[model samples]
Target: MVAFSTDTSPLPKTKKSLQLGNYGTLMSSQEMPEEYWTPLKLPPEKRVTSSRSDLTSVATDNLSELLDETIAEEQTTIDRVFAFLGFTANPFSSYADDVCNNKASDMRLSMLSNISAAYNAVSISMALDIMQDLYETTSKDKSLCSSALIAGMIVGQLAGGAIGDILGRHMAMAVVMSLQIVGALITACAIQSSFSIYAFIAIWRLILGIGCGGVYPLAATITAESNDDTKDGGKAVALTFSMQGIGYLLPPILTALLARFVPLRLLWRIILGFGAIPGLWLMVLRLKNQIARTNSQVYKSKRNMLTNAREVPVNVLEAIYVEPDLFRKMIGTGGCWFLFDVLFYGNVLFQPIVLSAAFGQAETVQRGAIDSAVVSLLALPGYFASIIAMGHQSPRFIQSQGFLMMAILYGSIGVFFQHLSRHKFALVLLYGGTFFFSNYGPNATTYVLPSLTFSSSCRSTLNGICAACGKAGALIGSMVFVFAASKFGEDIVLLACAVVSLIGMVVTICCVSETVIHDEQIKKPEVRMRVVISEPSLLDYFETA
Candidate 1:
């Protein structure tokens, strides 16, 4: 036990105000009277029990005493605590008091920390549309667009993870968003000029991929840090991920609406350009809120680790190698995500082509119209279903069931596709049915599993890596599906996907634990405190006993 004696005779006090870095205020130290410093004393019986209480109580009592002394030394400490609590209560109001007041400023800072998460679903969905345009423009040149986009995604994810760790989430997001804005502008310009179209699209896509990839880790890190309750953090992350459906929905809707007014070639450009709008808004919010302070601890720790190491400091790659358990878990989850992305992206990207093949050669505009409506409608229910189902089921159970269902559905579709004729309503029903099951399984699981597998410290890095692997699968699917369809037929490609889906289902069931259920089962112990002293003071010691 630690002890300190309070001096009843007051020392000469300085009136100078104290400034706190987090709150951004100058507060007076003379608010509490000198009498508040009367020696904290307890009777002899209580002094004997202090050592036996739980560790948490001892720590809390020690902390309270430290706080009391600090308050006596500087009266503004209580004011700071009150300011902090106020900021914690309501974070989103934009009134001047809310922005400028110390508590409000802290709240706004926390809000900014999480803003990147808010836009992730939108960015990912927009990237898919951009890839679609690239494929459409280069019909004969499929690999160029697919390879470039996939490579961009991989590189961006790696860079984003690294930079996010080094620079802090806000700065990293700002840099990435700036790059995205530039990429969007360049991509839009490239649509107008066909010269070096492949190279131009490739470069822009790579840049945009980096920004998109960077935001995922940044958002994950921010959410982990800002959230006090782990369950709330999980739910918040789950909700953010659920927005991927929104991202998935946006491009097609935008394409459908704008394709009529704009040229098809220019339509994607406008859509891609629109991708920068959210990023720009995020940048502005980050600047206004000054989120750098919340991010400082992470940055400082990373800096010290790098500077103080006698040996070559372990980078993410090295860390993964060192921590094989984490690596395996990440890889397992990532593999499941990969399978999901392949099937999901393959189905989405090739729906028009598949419909056209199923229906036979038809008017291009008519085909586009029918395919667009079918894809759009099928997606809406799946998104809503995902949101509802995500909350009710454990990620492991949902993902496992989803993969099994997807496999069964895809297999059924493959068998039925051969019998269905072009323009038949049954074909649309079959296709839509398959689409609905796609979200039920892998699509929803990929997003939820990452939040569960890792601790808060490395959640973003692990999630980003998993997301990159999923993109890799999408890339492979993009290339393989086109080539396989041209050679073996779409039915064969889908049958293969069904097999892969089953493998994922088995893997998920066998390997992944249900995090939500498991976390709830592990109870945190409650702690109580007992403070003791040999002598009694004028005031009675207020013990919770």
Candidate 2:
């Protein structure tokens, strides 16, 4: 019912050339006679009907406008949340040596690393219990069912990188963590209800794997970007990744405690359900702390927020395709990751079964839990050792050494399984040594290298691709190990893993480069400067001519 006016005053007369109305005529304002002037007039206004359909249309229009406004407000809130997480606020911020070396930045990255580790380890931890309870009793294809988690993870990791690029890392992480929470809750329910237990658990595990997969690249990339400026940037990144050791170490100890104190039947459900806690906490913190305060200040104006948002094109394909060199690097990094995980995840996921074989299936839950805990604990020192030595070592060297050592250890165990198993201490030492080397070398470096090699534009995607390759390898390895261990025996499986590690070592030496953290190479390009040229003078014009 708002009204609009269409009235206007005549323009003041021109001094000499007065414009005649669209007639290609000109007149002198001073010479033009007063009798020739005309007064301004407007047509009579008509009253329009406010019919029912018209009212309905107006109401609909008003509702649509209100909805649009609401959506805009919601989007602004989300942008602010992303800004708080430090992702969207400053698209062109420096990520040089000085910037990456900040104490605050390192701390934030460390927290993120820990959360990522916990998220990833959840499925593995649950796998241990599933092997004891459901796998043994269930009628379904246990290996295939168990491998579903890893398969889900592979898909999720690939999706996560693309999502991170398109949506921004903070937002992608939030969505990922939320998915993990949902997956965990569903898994807990499946455990509690006995109906179609194997199928339900397998489906839920896949969902959980997706969330875990999403964490890998994001955590590695964020940690690498944060620590890129420091002299110990690699050390910092390695330390952050080594947080996964703590994650691996926790489940056995937790399971041991639960077995001793709680009801035996409730243990698996409790373990599966507990994964939601850290994920929920992390998702909250990630959203809340996304953008830095300086970035928030810089982007206080709405125009700046819009501008910042536009700066980074969120197209994953464009990011990779635009830079062919980056895609080439992706092959090396992704390939190495694929090979490493074949050995690492394959062995780690089935470690409990290996232990059951070692100690006998008749071994009580508490003893099994304690022994697993003790063995898992053995990998921790290697992680800290890597952190200590990362500043001194090159990634290429560390990976090569780790892979070589793992091959040696695994080969020994495979070739002399009966001889080593006769001496329990020797067998444990060899098994734990493989873990130590894996953590110190390829496992840590694979995570760190991808972060440093690519431009920030496609770092997440590249990292995700690498991690997804690893998970795909994991899926293959897990399935292969189960089949091989059953048909060919554990010794052959171990030998196969040893061969895989050897292949990884060769790949590292031939394909992957020694990462050089050059500030200029990694830093986002500077905005182009437009030089203003002076107007041409007669001499300048003649000289040019």
Candidate 3:
């Protein structure tokens, strides 16, 4: 994200020679010799006359020849500079991996994605606080309105995923992130702009939701494509996805911190507006260096376009019909996400209410903050452990186990709610256990599996579909959790979540197959270079008479 710097420190002219290719190769041992240097010179010419038409033609031909030679030399010089930096003059040549695989850049992209995920959830926790200020609304209405934000996000996700596949992941991310910032700014200005709070907030939230929806496909696909092997690729992506836990954790920690210094009235605005800051920073980073920059050339190449045009589905609907096996797999992946999010978001978004019900609603803010912080802290280890496990274990196995553990935990929590509520420590352990399995299991795997399930041409499209399905579950979960809990009590909500988890476990075990991509298998589809140029493709770098 930082600008490439020029070395301003003085150096001996002899040492200033460019180093070419790998670490050991040097372009020169000494300063250029006067004889080796070419200087542009032209021979004196006589003006052509009417009687000397043949001479005139000869002079004109000589001038044209000299101009061509000069231009060729200039092009050769530029080629030498490019080659020294590991670029090719031959447009047909596939780029070298060294030019493409930047570990630091990839990690930075992951960090940006983490920020995006974090911002997406932060708004959920702050929704009730925002609604209270804008209007006097009951908790159920507030919760329903909040679900609309995530609904907008789902709509955005479907669009973003399709955009990534059709246009390019980088371009899609750029557009998504830009709109997220605008959404945040607009939300912040809702009061100042004098627009109806409901309409304005809803419109802005939708924009924010779109940005959030795009993040999964763009981040997951770009990381998968960038790394290209199950072991390293899986770990790289899991590491990126795990940052969402930190995102989940931050809202409570930040709210707790801000609550001490800021008044409640102004706090909601700050929280809503603050979401934009991360997106803005990430947008700047993405602009400087995009996710998977090297793939852009391959995506645009004539051969690749023709090949992809025939092989890759233009959209998920087309993909479902054209590639039946892929469609079935998409169903498994998307279904798992749907079931998991029904449990995950239901628990996560309404953690405060659940805690209030358990501990009694006194000091709601402090209790919610304390409980959220504790649960989130417990979740971190799971995210990291999953990152390590992703390298050694099968994603399907991990995901299935997670779902099973969560189902057990959810059932236990629901059955023993009265008994556990009497004992704070026991309740915390049960709550923390669910959070742990959620990350180590389906939550992380859902993101990774979708990226791997489909071909490169349709990876984002299918991922988007899978993710959109998950968001649909989240929207439903968020909407129903408040009403269901109020009408039927928290026990029923917990039991339903447990049922959802059990279903997810079954779906994962039966439908979701292990993603078995290897390095060699992945390499074939990527633009592969048959040769690595050791020196610049210029006449000066070659032996000549």
Candidate 4:
């Protein structure tokens, strides 16, 4: 076994203009971003505290400003609905796909924040071999140690979901990022001369895992929710997740460059310590905009826990139960993610093993390093292609297409194993296709779909659940590749991957929606008219200032 250790390490809210629930036909407006997924649906009536007297009592300036914004918001809603109905151009590309990036720095920052997860992997990949010797651990112990990191990440993802919904995205991001720095440093310093060192290392890796895993949902949802511009509506979100490709290549490149000069013991420490730098920088950058600005669309779209709780179920279970379609979507997204990670992690962790067998083992360190870097590099195009594809196709279409292509590719490799194995170049081409389709297909879509599918109130929570399932699949993929390769040989393992890919295709076709805009608009269009308002709720845009 090549020792599977380091792989796949991969950010809101507001109070309201209190006393504003369905004032008559007043559903939510475009101000509430969750409503942005589709046309605003007029909500059913609730408590009505607003009367003619109360309206007159309010200041004229406040009322006038509120009405102006509301009218503008309703107008935006009207545009989106007409666009959805094909009466106008797309809301995103209406003026020929002008990107909104110049205006969305906070969102772009949230997208880059996910790059920190890649740093966590670097520490483990660089330290693994050195620690095996220093700790005098058995191969079993080494594998277990790495598993500790993955386990921590898995648990952290689950908890992070609830924390995100409960505390808001920015706060949760800041908290977890601080924890990551502490965990990385502690793990770097775990170089004592005793068996206890192994225990110490494992504990800290687990801690780091929690921080790393928590970033997935927080960063992804932040970008997805904050994104307001793109000729291709989902391109921003796709770019956000595509950063993972750069993350995977970073550790090996760093290790290769540093190994020549640094002392072995000191080298591992430096590598692990380095993971904290990106997190520190990002934390400070994020704090500068700790909360979204009041006048911004990003701010208006927030899901308020204090004032909007009555409308947004804090508990995901309650939300799903109230709307069974949510339950079905949860299954679809979760299942596709689960299946994709199984294939992705399996292929990435074992690539070196397969490459050596096909190309013949490299006789020199330089050659081996080059091979590793090349394999990682090949996956980048797929990530880049997915961003472009997102501009034109629905996630449902992209995901299903990717899965079907992968199934065919894996199946072809399996059936012609003997012939392809003999032709090293042909086998290499086939192998690279897997990474291409994986990134282009379900890998990016799994993350993108959940962020857009659910309402802001439960977005992080739902996306967290979906992402955590991917981690669970990671554990299974890493283990399965080992057992199947050992027991049935590599050829059979490839065939089995094809089978899994086929199942993923089926699940995606049945479960995933065609597009974020159309499905949501057709299902729940926003409705608005001043009915009665209850003091229990406030207008989302009304700030005391």
Q: What is the lDDT of residue 139 in candidate 2?
A: 34
lDDT of 2 by residue, 238-338 (tens): 76687787776667677777777776556777777777766665445534543442255532442232222323444556656655366457666888888
The better candidate by lDDT, 1 or 3, is 3
How many clashes show up per model? 2, 10, 2, 26
Poorest stretch of ten by lDDT in candidate 4: 3-12
TM-score of each: 0.63, 0.68, 0.70, 0.71
Top TM-score hit = 4
**Which regions of candidate 1 are displaced past 4 Å?**
1-143, 191-194, 228-230, 262-268, 285-324, 345-350, 357-370, 516-545
Report the lDDT tens digits of candidate 3 across residue range 267-322: 66776777777666655544433334334554234222222212233344554444
Model 4 lDDT per residue over 1-545, tens place: 01011121110011122112212222222223332221222232311235534432332334345545664454566456534433222223211111222114434445445666766854585577656545566776677668888898887777787676666665577666776788888888885664577678788888888988887887777666546433533776787787777777766677678767767677678767777776666555444433443444644333231122223344555544444377668878888899988876547644765677676786543355456678888889888788767757888999999999999888888788778757877878888998899889998899888877876556788788898999899889988887888888777877888889999999998988886842234343232212221111110112211
Q: lDDT of each prediction vs. the true structure?
A: 0.54, 0.62, 0.64, 0.65
Clashes of 3: 2
Ranking by TM-score: 4, 3, 2, 1
